[model samples]
Target: MSDRTQEMEEQVAYLHKTVEELSDVIAKQDMELRALTQRVDLLIRREADRQSEAPGAAIFGDERPPHY
Candidate 1:
């Protein structure tokens, strides 16, 4: 094979390896993100329930506002 063809083949191999590694990382990140999203949803529902149950409930375990 010509030098140019050999160089192109090497580049293609490297790119394929990189792509596979990136795919694995992305899949792991997607799973973690899904778990985090579910946790956030649960927290939101819990907070909403708390608010509905008691309107004057302390938002941050106390009556002071954020500005205080």
Candidate 2:
């Protein structure tokens, strides 16, 4: 094959490998994001439940200033 053709083929191969690697990274990140989202949702629900259980208990149990 001509040098130009060989160079093109190599570039294509490199690009294919890069794309596969990026795809794998993206898939892993997507899974991690989903897990994190679920965790956050669970935490939010728990916090809401706690707040509802105790009306006077602030979010972090910090009382408002007297001035309000």
Candidate 3:
């Protein structure tokens, strides 16, 4: 192959490798984001349940502390 053709092929190969690496990073980040979202949802539900089960015992998020 001509030098020009070989250089273009190498460039294309490099781009493909870079794209694959970026795709893997994106996939990993997506999985982590999903896991974090699930954790947040669980915490929200747990806190709501706790508040409901002890309506007067729990301090409201917006309310000041008794010492204040």
- Give the Cα lDDT of each candidate: 0.89, 0.90, 0.91
Ranking by lDDT: 3, 2, 1
Q: What is the TM-score of candidate 3?
A: 0.78
Give a tens-digit lDDT track for model 3, residues 1-68: 99999999999999999999999999999999999999999998898788889956854855898899
lDDT of 1 by residue, 3-40 (tens): 99999999999999999999999999999999999999
Best by TM-score: 2
Candidate 3 minimal-lDDT segment of 10 residues: 55-64
Tens-digit lDDT track for model 2 on 1-68? 89999999999999999999999999999999999999999998897788889967667535676787
Looking at model 1, residue 51 earns an lDDT score of 74
What TM-score does each of the candidates earn?
Answer: 0.73, 0.82, 0.78
CA RMSD of each candidate after superposition: 3.4, 3.7, 3.2
Candidate 2 residue runs with Cα over 4 Å from true position: 58-68
**Runs in model 1 with CA error above 4 Å?**
55-68
lDDT of 3 at 62: 58
